[model samples]
Target: MVLIRRMLAFLMLASLSASVPAFAHKDHDRKQHAAEAMHNSAHQEGAPAASRMHQEPMHGAMEMEHSADEPPLTFTDRLLSWIGRLHPIIVHFPLAFFPAALFTATIGRRRASFATPVQFLVVAGGALAPLSALLGWLDAIGMDPDPLLTVHRWLGTMIGALGAALAVWAWRKPDQDRSGLMMAALTVLTAAIVVQGWFGGALVHGVDHMNW
Candidate 1:
């Protein structure tokens, strides 16, 4: 249990240190892109109105052509893109851990000796949950906004938070018996995971992912 807690603490620190700068840099890039877009819009507005109207189609085509001719991604960019693609793979860890914790805890309620294992699962889940969420955000940072994506992102975030909370609850009361409140929280976490999993699948497989 001590080892699990230490690992989680380490992960928290690493995530903070790594994410802050990466996100800051991404934000800077976004602001720069937005400013450039706005400047181009302003330039178009300053053009003769009739000419602007006549040139709109050509302007869009030219932008597309320019994008097509843009240089390929640099090595670093390609590596980052490959890393971003790992989100789906990494997400399975927490997806299994939280539910597995709930299951272990449920069984542990009957057998007192299962407490240690329950604690282990909770801490493991908590540690990986945030990492999964971070990877998801990085992967989707440049994706087109959509309702399903929005729901999946926020719900996945909420589940990660809940996983962390569950770990803390278990750590603080390591030997304490599971109370009604803890059971209820576990139930809610499980349900949230189910819903979040649906949304995640829908994001990848379309809304009919669970049509059956």
Candidate 2:
């Protein structure tokens, strides 16, 4: 009976010893899986931040390249600006000079003694008319193309023609009584020039339709 009991106790101890290795393997597998899962979670959490950091420098580089590709403002820009500044003053001279010449011519013809001064003013005003017209045309060309430019151009041509005609008449008149008639015509032409000048001024300063 004692011998049988010892053999049964040994068999029970052997079975318990065999199960210990399986429990240890299962615990090791669980720890390995938990460690792998923690590593994967950390990587996933950092991915977005890493992507943004990579993209930020690329975005900054692209912006820098775009700015570098742009052209700089040039000397033509400054020249045009100066032309625009002088435009109004150049245009106004003919407006004043033409009318003054006509007035002086009228007074001179009435008195018959002041014709020389009137003739001189007429020639001077006529010479200035074409110059003013040229400058005005240049200024118009610098601006954006518009329908108003057509009107301004035609008016300038008409004024130039009338000024030239008046200058010739004043120069050629031979102390004749017909000087009064020529002066009267000049007065009427000057009136028309004044109206045209006003229209040009409105185009520039009134609606702000022009570009420098």
Candidate 3:
């Protein structure tokens, strides 16, 4: 009976000892799995910062390339913008002068009261024409050359010369029929200047002639 009891006790202890190794193995496996999961999580957290660092140089290089491709603004551009604004005002003098002179002279020849004012308009117009021509020439030369540019140049020159000639003749005349002749010359010159001004407008606003 004692032998039977001893055998039963030995069997229970052996079974308990075998179960301890299996529990220890399961615990070790769980710890290994936790360690691997922590390592993977750490790598995932660092990935985006590493990617941003790798791409930063490429973004900087692209920006530099874009800057290199763009052209720089220049002094000539500023001068041209200023001149463009002034061009319309400068062109009107020649358009008004010759006709005003003629009208005044005709009225003065008939009535005598409109002569002085008309003469003043003629002289002022004549003076303004040359200045306009000079500015026009500067604007033309500053731009790329075109076929129509020559026409503008010659017309401006002719208008300026005619204005100056009429002005001089008007100045020299002693308030007689010769003043009428000078007024007629101014009238013709005024017509010519108006045509020239129209062409200049067409060159600027209509065509791409003067524009860069």
Q: Count the backbone clashes (under 3 Å) in each candidate.
A: 0, 0, 0
lDDT by residue for model 2 (126-207), tens: 7767767766666665477676678778788778777777667667764642365766767776877866766776685864
Write down the worst ten-residue block by lDDT for model 2: 174-183
Which parts of model 2 are misplaced by more than 4 Å? 1-85, 174-180, 207-212
What tens digits encode model 3's per-residue C-alpha lDDT throughout 1-212? 99999999999999999999999999999999999998897788788878889999999999999999988758987676577566568878767767777767776776666656766776777787777777777666556777667888888878877777666655665365236567567667767866776677777687654566
lDDT of each: 0.83, 0.72, 0.74
Candidate that beats the other on lDDT, 2 or 3, i.e. the better one: 3
Clashes of 3: 0
What lDDT score goes with residue 25 in model 3?
A: 100
Native-structure RMSD, model 2: 37.1
Which residue pairs collide, candidate 2? none
**In model 1, what lDDT does residue 149 have?**
93
- Write one digit per residue (lDDT tens) for candidate 1, span 1-212: 99999999999999999999999999999999999998998788766766879889999999999999989878887776777788888888888877787788787787878888888887888888887887788788668999999998888888888888878888888875266677688788789878988988898899997887
Candidate 1 ranges beyond 4 A from true positions: 1-67, 71-79
> After superposition on all CA atoms, how large is the RMSD of candidate 3?
34.9
The predicted structure with the larger lDDT, 1 or 3, is: 1
Q: Cα lDDT for residue 212, model 1?
A: 72
